[model samples]
Target chain A: MITFGKGNLRVPKWSKRVFMVAAGCSPFRKYFPEYKLEELVMMGYKMMLEDNNLKLSPLEIKDSIQFAVYGQFADHFQDQLLCEAKIHDYLGLDPLYNVGIKTGGATGGTSILMGAQAIASGYANCCLVAGWERMDEVDTRTGNFYISTAACKDFETRMGRIYSSYYAPMANRFAWAYGLSDQVRAKIAIKNRHYATMNPNAQQPGDHTEEEVLSSRMSAYPLRFLECCAMTAGSASVLLCDEEMAYKLSDHPVEVFICGGSHTLRVADRRPMDIPLLPNEKPGMYDEFLKKNPRWPGFESFLAARFAAYLIYRMAGIKEPIEELDLVELHDAFTISDVQTYGDIGLRPYGQEVDYVESGDAYYGGKCPSNLSGGLLGTMHAVGATGIWQAAEVFWQLQNRYDYIHGDPKWWKRAGKKKPKNWKSLQVKDPKQGLWVSHAGVGSHVTVGILRKAW
Target chain B: MAKPAYEKAITTKYIGTPLKLHDEKPAWVIESPRAMTHIHTYGLLTPFFEGLTKGKLMATKCVNPKCPQGSTWLPPRADCPDCYERMKWVKVPSVGTIYSFTLVDYAGIGIEMKTPYWQIDVAIKGVDTIFKGYLESGKPEIGMKVKAKFRTEKPTHTILDVCWVPA
Candidate 1:
């Protein structure tokens, strides 16, 4: 961990608020307004852009803005040279020199961390990160086909499932192995949306009843449309700068610091071709394969959470159970993902984390208030940008900038005298540790990262 | 359709017994991305890959002729990490049958494939190995012989060559 002295550079306390800035997100629903899914997503993106004062065409703005960072574009960003050129032209920044794109799930948080690190290292006086994706340009099925490539397409998709199906294999494994219930997975969905209702930036908003989430149309046996995140066109950006530059540049600056980052791959991801349904190595025998790679029984969502948490804790140096943290921002790509991440992250023992949601501990104003920024479930999922966006929310919460449109809580009790603070501080109570968890699954490819507030 | 490698014998109990599966004698070889010294990054290789275009399957083989695990590298590798040798290129068979399968209803972020279809694990003969691929036609069942077929927008260079078919 690194810390800068006030003497390093000083403009004003207000500038201290954002000595370094990071990330701007645009969640676009206007482009696909006919669907409720699209509308919620649009609102989410719009809120992100509006909060940042970011007004530029995606092309004109690709990399020219302060602390320039952008999302994945198959034709543009995918082509490193084109992306590099766009960065130079739009942000007037040389990516090869100081710019680059960090994509995939949780990319939003990773990018923010990248920019934050640059600022912390004094590599740049100011930096910016932004991500957005528009699903309206293509029909749902076509868009999904492209997205499915993120997983082990040949193995997972060919086996009758897309990326989401990958989670099912795990979900099945978890359910079979740990005895987790579908109802528990449903609680994750309800809790996430419950928190999302407090987050104005979220694409989907509602105080989802547990019954509604459980009974909603099952996209898969254990997952419902309510359980999955909506495809959204939105962008988010954050600016970062050294304390002195930040002091001079803006008021209400949030001090940004990164604790740590780590990444790991899952089993199916390790082997694509011949990724056996079962891994027993017997020649001329299919039965052996099935026996070795028994369909992982149980809910994948819970498993994802547990694995993610495990990785996060390992990186963040938290020996205590992860539930100790005050806030969490998981991928929640699907509601089940939230349950899995919670368990995977070790917030609760296996098969027990979903109870955290029921206890309201994962809810806004509850202990740990997860996805207070309305997670991917409420926030549109722009692939790599999703994680980066989670990081921004953590930064905002730590800085206590909950009043902005981007800072609205995902839920609120109508009768409460005052709205809840977007920020929740465990530091005052624990004073030792705070953690953030983020995850991404591209087909069979899954990676998790954890961040801690610098002490 | 070819007769299965196994013929259900008088003793049906033996059928329920699990058998060990191994890569066929000739290891499946697929093309390697020459630019990448190791396994080619999927995104970067898509442009140069011919799998999508020729309706063929591609993968890399261990460069080290001496490595014992050379035959096990799927998606092909450019080098044998264990022995540190550059890999040779090879093409996998496009034909095979459903070894097993699953249906995915819900997809993750950025996924579009819908539910209620088969995701089959097919075995290619020339490549002589099982590869997971979509079966556009026919339900997935053990010993359901199938062949690889290509999609409409066949990119001259891609891995989505022959999709699985019920032969």
Candidate 2:
């Protein structure tokens, strides 16, 4: 088990390497009314090029990353991989090794975690972790069509499954099984959107009311548009290097300590011992999979939070109830996801999330501040890049410079407190450890990483 | 242009003897490039919805059968993820009600259908039951009642062939 930290490094370090990075932002419904998947990929590439003079054609970039991670948004894995491979070639990074893709909705964070592990494990001296998706640009019908393919192609996609339909059953099960009220889920949306307002980069940033959430067009029963994650076109990338190299690359660097990752191919397949389900197993798994049985607290945010807690216990060597963590960044792919995430992290008791939101206890300075820098619900998914984006947010917060860079004055004003110099900067006065969690696959794959401030 | 003799009867036959046999194989093998509506395939990892031939949509149930109810998956699976045990194929009822829906006005790559298509959320029996498919009927309204139609053109029984129709 390799251990990592901020200073007194045990591992050999390189210089001027990426300590923290991500692709870019793309929030659908917020970025534009319509865009294509291909266009979104170009947008992310453009951002990468702006910072670095990596001269390469779209095709080159696609091909270069072919061996890399693939998201649900791509038309063909080969096409996306080759397109990225070409870009890497242009960037002058060759022989991208163990090229493979991992899928979890908002899976970008996990990719970064994997990339960080690869770097830490000495698989590669330096590696780029990227997540991109053209959600807005792609045909909604086609995009959802692909999502259908990802979820359960034959039954869902060929049967003409609606995009939100993929989550509805799960969402319903979350509500019913957890004994959660619809109103609580609505409040989750309100709170996350409010958090998004603090993020300038967010796709749909604004304050929302419970009424607005309830009134939003219903995507699925008990799940309004506000409660769901709006699709977007965006990408994120994080460049990782050895500890020594990361320190040398930039004066300000964020180190990653991977606690552990547990991703399940099928979420419903494994039931954790601690979490309880309301009803007993139904006769047919297919029937349960198809019906609107609600999975209580069924959201990406909650899963990320739970996984983070699990990681915290693993890293801290404590199995006590998870209320000790100070901060978190989860894949709030949807408002409901964020709401359930609150409870999943044990920040609030199940079904009491509305009270938590009403108390304003789930904010940056709350008992356990969640999605302080915005989330997929607020920032924009960028398809594959979501996980990495979540990781980057945590990195920014650890630096304690988020407010300074993003600048959400309203958050401070609402708290009736003085504003900090930088919200993205780490605020750990004598910090020792921090935790990060991200999940994809419609809340199927949950991973957690624990990081220390480094000696 | 002169109309062909089968113009009136030219509707796509989703259910038939040959179509039923088609469910045993992958759609790629049976579908003409023109008939191919999907651009990608997820293989066994995702539920194929091809099992409608046997009148069942398969799903993976959480094998920790000891855990609370509702931990199971639908469409049936080969193994239980929670217990890591073999899964049992369970048949589901075809009845469902609309949970949500959308009208897509654009087409995508590999999707030959024109815009203004109706996508629906049709409820299936059992916990957390719901599946998607083209709505071949009047404008979709919430609370609309529909039943699952098994398609035969599916190349395998594991493929999802059900479509929701007004009851």
Candidate 3:
């Protein structure tokens, strides 16, 4: 098996501590026609600056911003190139110099990574990390085609033009390799969509049954429509700063530790390699299991996610992730991806991913409950904005303000929806730490971030 | 009423057709696209695509003695990823096991294949990477034996040019 070099395995370090003080997102929808893309961005940006009970005024916070990082996944969907310039000017942050980040579905997490880098490097004391996507302009099939282009055009894109077709193979292989059932995947869809009932910004929240999810029209066989995240339009943002600025902005600031890892864009190219161990894992822990399935990442797991978790667990000094993390927000772009990640991030060991969901640990009020934000499955897969929204949800949960942000009537009204009479809070009780995983392109890129409440 | 001279005389009249608005209530939303074209190139990997039409499954391998890995790759890259050196072309065995498979029932717009077909990732012999292709016939399951069936008669010149059938 191929092994990593010593230099390749060094844990990442930052010169300064980073914290996230505030996050905001526009109400997500399958088709948001009331506002332009810039307007949606302004809505989220304004919410971050004005709401969240920040100590500084919106104008003052705008004044304090030194640099900006923007994430927009596909120019083809938005039909506009250089969208960062338009969004930056619309937010009235002129001449502040902004950089655009693109990492497919991981753009939002990568944007935060960029913004945090500026803070950690002492480049900017306060930085803005914003992300947006406008996919309503295109029909669903066209949008799927646009997304599939993210796959390798020559060898893969045409084989199945939809992203689900790409992930479906992994789902099938995962089921074969580890005996994953369509039932387990359906349960994830049900749980996340049920959680979406509490999220005002959710796009496809539904109280679905396993029968409904399994019976839903097939995108690629065994992967029903309900199991996949649909195209959406929305925006989300977060403000990152150094330690001093974080405390100055809010009485409750969360410490941020984020790291990223990437694999080959095409799954066809992921060569056999040794499985990198997480902080809690021992050297030879996977030896017995590897005897049967020698392919390390094999179609069943995401190496990028495992590599990211390997780094962040060490950097943040996290050892038992399933117990230490109060809540988690997985990409959930597909149910199989979410289930596969249980092993990759050490929430569960490899081959036991199905048990993570079956044990009820992945549900509300369970140990390290996942996708409390409704996830990309039920909420918004507005591509670029998805990762940012996950962080926003985690930030709110960590601040103990899930009710104020999600249960309030104003937010429901703002989204042009009547608040359900029985809006139950999925808030983790007094959560101290939460983690969000932003993933892209069948495990090509993944970022695992932990937010610890520092109040 | 007049000749609208400035529109035509000074500049070409708006030759573009009026874009149809999908929504006009809270906001005007328009979805208009005439057409688009992208001139993509196979570049150095042209030989791999050409081999499909010639009924040959060609792969590239790293021959550098200093390289850590020297395995052949289908969907071949012109350069070896480990050594960062030019690779040499070589014919490979077309038979492989089905490492994985997916039945694509729904596809994106302009998909070349018909809907509800078996798409398979084959673990070809001697190739370090699994090659993605479609199964022209037979049900696909892990460990199912399959052999390459090239479109030697009429070529699409795409990855579609090569498919697999139960051996």
Candidate 4:
């Protein structure tokens, strides 16, 4: 590993392998009144130490942990700026560098990135990244208020618009442009619920019929209550260290490499299209396209995820993402968001995700299995912790140690009796690469990482 | 695919019974009085609100010939994004087209909107920026022409001081 010093400091190359040797998470629940944030964080940390399987003594392991990074959002319910320091004290670690990150839903992914950077820069031999959210402490009204803080306070919240309303327009425009029907959207919900039944940690587990999803109560016109993720309280964490240190700590190490990240423009400053249509098009065609196509300026929420994915692929030297990567963990806060992300990440062309979803290419045992851990839609969504959980799932998949829980037998038969194949099993058969992506704040900020299994 | 051995079922325990309302007040109601505060916008954005209170829509345009992007900007900024030069504020027409819209079906904290209210993102006729506001009347349609309706009787010095209407 490259070490930083007064005169030896140099830009580290992306070729360096920053291995994630240990990962842990608390059972995601709809509510958690019995556990405090510190208790949850300590639970994850202790679990990580146990999972590490290090032969060293407790003091040795503690000395190896050079720093810690905490990710969270909505400080109104907890300690705001001092949360990292508070966690440091609670963990009883030697004085080391610690900081907190707040990037809406991308907090977890950002924290992981920060931890990797710390190890790569030689600032620390090992770094602990943790994220948690206690949304169940507040009621729906208070939760809505807290979540709305991510949006433009002067424009969106001021005009009585929530995240559902913000994402509804994009969903409508994509449906209109791609000729997608309500049934297509319902299918996504059903698919996630199907996988959720296999994830014991999932908040909502069971089979949901397409009709059931279509008839669900509508929150915003295009987005229904069933189509959105459940509010959950949980914590997720991962331990990052240098390649040598990882080998010394764990037998199975997943090498994680951050490709890149990007942020989009403000909601008010953005236009429908960042790039105008061809001049060869007939008069008023651009205007008509803009009317039907919801484009945002500087990578509006939908485009931001796509842009980040493309940048990551480019940085990681991945020419064909679908063929090169074995699996993907997309941020699926909303079904439409997940579907559009498939197209944005270059798995399919724009407006062609409907064909991909229908072709079973995105399903387990299909061309590219996504969100085998029940995703945010099936698994609960605990804002800051969701992204880190995605990364941890990927690490498990790379190590070929992921577990699956089968859903109801009746629903399984209805879904063609095809058991959901764990991508980790496939990796064991033909080991390769995987990816994790997440975004926050109405798609203003996005983070993407590519991971590979180290033999 | 092989089915893995199921582990012991994991569950969460609640510290107390689910919270219930004792009186007619909603479960989410704060027992103590809480003060709602306004976020003050300053610096380059002060004039934008000043124009709203005066029943006018203002935008900024970069006149530098050397600047690559000499386009006009709504929600006016002090400097050109491309050239980093001072941009002069200019009055623009209130008419525009609905770029996109969504009907709010649920109301939450800090929102006085009734159910099924319309929110539109309008692309101004001359300005290059898209402004978000609520519709006064008629159902929202993409590409529908709209005009700004300023709150003349009482101005709040906020973006809500202006609403959109079918033109």
Candidate 5:
């Protein structure tokens, strides 16, 4: 049994407050041969410097940066090592110390966490966090194999040479244990893909019906092709600053609260333990849940996500997440993964995750809409870029520029696509706070970050 | 006179095949093929894989009394995570109940088994953790009883050596 000591229970406290000033990302696609990896990173980097309405000039901001952090998931995919040095030098920020962060799919969020820590620790007044993945370097199956190796090579990777097979068993167990249905799973795909229709950066946008999702090609039993995010080639970036540098950088700066948690690499090795309570939950709230589910985070749930949420909610001092957070950008790598986070993050109590979507809380114009940027399911899952893109989406929404960023014809032209005449604005009205979950390797590493509007 | 004349002068040539161009549309994308074999050691867990080929399932158990959990591990670990103590190998029952299952229709590159196979996670009584294996030939469901079937004749010597069949 894994028990948290008093030291472990202590919430993370920053030496100084951290703030996010700007965010940017390139249009995502399954294959991007038009630009080299460095050039693609430049595309997003330039957007962050120029487009976010920062007070300082792009070069002035560059001159102000004290350090940089890059997140790239796998060297096998890149076929090159020390990509940070190349990217750092390419960005014209030579001689500035930079480090690379890798935590599977959570690399992006972890990079941001590192950047935020630099600001929080007074190590840097201004820090740059950028992440990217070029999955098109290999064919789809080879890419999947590389990703699957992230699973425990000895135990799990040999069982199913694909990642979806890893999640499909969980889906089966969850459906059996919680009385969840295939219909509920299909709805998520339809919703996220439909939401993708509005995203210029979305790689796969469609107005798919429930039938279409249900009838799609099966990757694993009960999980169709559309239920999973495809490999993407793109990059995303965000800038973090200390409190003093925040107002100097932008008229709209967002306060950042982020913390991470990790569990065993093998899902089978997860020992049952007490569900760490969120700030709003009570001591015995999950007692009945424990009695029913037995294993608190069995194949059905993620302890890493739960643990991260447990710490972040307390660190951010959020009492009721469903009520407090205005909008959310979840790591919807898979539909089930998206739904599973609802309970883990206290969006719903343990047994009522489906109700979050059923109750319309996860939809646009709902109580707390999620994945308003179409999420990983719709837009992209350039593994390392995903979490940064999620944060950028929330940052833009909090800035009330969702329409300008996502709805403008200029962005459409940049992506080489015509803006749809029926494009709908997914802007959450004047948002105060939002949260995003960056997860990796069957809930191996997860970071829950909250971005509160601080103008 | 400076050099005592090397037995064979160092000579190298481009014996490697030219890497094929993957795509040449906007940017010249070249295919860089990587073929490698990792020297993996089972180490203390060698007995577990070796036992699979011998029609036995070996698990590692922590016998320390001070340890909070005296758990047995399949995909047996050398040390107990709870107390950081070395665990001893023990034989576990080869039968288990299906806790969960899935049919993998399409898989990644380098998949050994044939497609549309049932992969099951089996929960043995003594083992604290569920073990994953493929069902040999049968439909799978939760709570279905299954027993281990090893590949003894021509052992793959991998985890694939041990599979499950309907009990």
Candidate 6:
């Protein structure tokens, strides 16, 4: 967290040891009928304290916290801007500084980055980053409207492009370019659900067969209902601290570093269209414009994610991500996004993600185990909390603290008679490094973070 | 067999018997009065809208000789994004091709169109930016020729004044 305060003061290079000491998540469900937003936040905070083995009371812990950051997707409650302040008061935390973040689905990861910056800049010894969304209370029609706020108001919204609709064209183009088959998409859906069954926190933690996924009602042309993320109610929190404080707090701290992030042009700006010429130009003006401004890779889709991943890999000193990183957790809002992201993140070549998916290299115990936490597909998508959940999963995996669930024949029977080929052990023997990527606002805002286990 | 402690607690709290499982629904439906309002001074885009009323599509072009971005923008901006200089409006040809499109299976809020409508990004002739609109008729296809069908009789002074049709 670089302190963008007065003078834009920079933290000393030596004090750049930011570590994730503790992480907690509320049980993901379709709806939290028993609790409200503030209560859910408090529950997550308490769980984080418990996970860190801090037996101190809420007030005691609050006094030690120097700063806090909160992330929420939509206003489940009436007060939108003051939600973070309300949560701070509800938790009885007297942090020196606190702020709220609303970056569509990327809020969780962005909040984590802010927390790390706060600790790294010596502004706070410990910072609490939390994200939650109570979406189940809203009807489908209302929810669609709120989610569409992430798109461009003047162009996308006015043109009647909703959240799912934005991805529809991307899916269409990808299928048209790569000849993406239904079998490949169904496989991706089944793989995520299969991993979800192993996760107790998963909202839809049941095995889904290929036939079930293929037969699911289509939401968009290429995206089906089962292939989409479930609207969920949950909260997640992570505690970040300086290097010295991290060692004193936890035996195994996952050292996290924000590699890089970028915001891309709007969908209208980068669409595959020729540049209009000036009135005076001759017949060769359009061709001249093309020469000066060649078409870029992001013109198709996932532009920001591609740009962010390139910077991240470069910052982490990783020349080859597929061979270097132990695991990756992507924001798979739609199954097509997962397929597109694999190539965007440089795990595989563009348009060759179908080969990677068909090869079973993305599953657990494969070449590159991705979304072992079931991703957004298997794990419930609380919108704002998803990015934080992805980071927490990496933290747990790095420390080997997560509950390891092996292949079970009984669970397979419940999801229909389909079993994964290599379900031997979903656990990574020793993961040194992992990456977490998330996006918001129609692929405009993207944030990628790299986590390395500090021995 | 005796009921589990957790089950007994839940049943006792609600009623003597266990609570019935049912599909979850919101307690109340909120009809939100949502409206997207923009106060445009028409500082630079006045002529662009005026062109639409006359059944003409227009864009802004940077007159600076050395300016990048090819001195052109669709849905024109006040200044050139690259050179940051004032731009002049120019008439764009109505005939274009579909750059990309999506069939809206579900209509969104504030959208007056019926379901199963075609929303397209039409690349106007000689224009760098794609103009977004719905096709007047016929299914959308990539690279398919399309021409602007403006509501010249009753101009709305909005982007909706024009629709795309097969050329």
Say which docking band candidate 6 falls in: incorrect
What is the lDDT, from 0 to 100, of the residue A119 in candidate 1? 58
After superposition, the stretches of candidate 1 with alpha carbons farther than 4 Å from their true spots are A1-67, A73-102, A152-161, A246-317, A321-324, A349-360, A403-434, A443-455, B1-102, B105-115, B118-167
Instruction: Report the Cα lDDT for candidate 3.
Output: 0.91
Model 6 residue runs over 4 Å out of place are A1-15, A52-61, A76-79, A271-294, A404-425, B1-43, B46-50, B154-157
* Residue lDDT tens for model 3, A307-335: 99999999999999988999999999999
Q: Can you write out model 4's per-residue Cα lDDT over A1-455, one digit (the tens) per residue?
A: 01123442222244456888877777677766556777777776776676545556546677889888888866864635677787788888748878888878888888888888888877777888888887776667667766776777666676654577777766766665677778888887887777776765677756888878978887777788888887788888888888888887877778877743444335556544442211122355445445645453322235556556655665566777777788888888888778777766777755567876888877778777788778888886887788888898788777765642123343244223444444123232354788888778767777888888776
Residue range with the least summed lDDT across 10 consecutive positions in model 3 chain A: A1-10
Among residues 3 or more apart in sequence or in different chains, the pairs in candidate 5 whose N, CA or C atoms overlap within 3 Å are: none
Residue-pair clashes per candidate: 121, 128, 0, 2, 0, 9
In model 4 chain A, the worst 10-residue window by lDDT is A1-10
Mark the 10 consecutive residues where model 1 chain A has the least summed lDDT: A272-281
Lowest lDDT 10-residue stretch of candidate 3 chain B: B3-12
Ranked candidates (TM-score, high to low): 5, 3, 4, 6, 2, 1
Model 2 ranges with Cα > 4 A deviation: A1-73, A76-81, A95-100, A158-160, A177-179, A250-252, A259-309, A316-323, A348-359, A408-434, B1-74, B77-167
lDDT score, candidate 1: 0.50
* Local accuracy of candidate 6 as per-residue lDDT tens digits, A144-199: 76677667655466566467777766676667656778788788888887787666
Q: Per-residue alpha-carbon lDDT of model 2 for A1-455, expressed as tens digits?
A: 01123442222222322244223333334334233344444444454433322344434443433224333335442135555554455544467553435554646656765666566566655566666665543445545555655654434444334445445544554554445577776666666666666565567655788788888876545567776676665656555656664554445556565532343333332222233211221234324432442332223224334545544454444333234555667666655566555555455545555555667666656655666665666666666767666765665555555544356564344223334443343243333344555665555566665444432
lDDT of 4 at B126: 70
lDDT of 1 by residue, B1-167 (tens): 76665854444455444433332333322222212243635552342254556555666566465665555344444555556676566666656655545555644433334456555555455332345556676766655788777764734233445467777
Please report, in order, the local distance difference test score of every candidate based on alpha carbons: 0.50, 0.51, 0.91, 0.71, 0.91, 0.72
Fraction of the reference Cα-Cα interface contacts (below 8 Å) that each candidate reproduces: 0.22, 0.18, 0.83, 0.56, 0.76, 0.27
- Predicted candidate 5 versus true structure: per-residue lDDT over A138-234, tens digit per residue: 9999998999999999888878789999889889998888888988988888888888999999999999988889899999998899999999999
TM-score of every prediction relative to native: 0.60, 0.62, 0.98, 0.84, 0.98, 0.82
Which candidate comes out best when scored by DockQ?
5
TM-score of 4: 0.84
DockQ for the candidates, in order:
0.10, 0.11, 0.68, 0.26, 0.78, 0.19
Winner of 2 and 3 under lDDT: 3
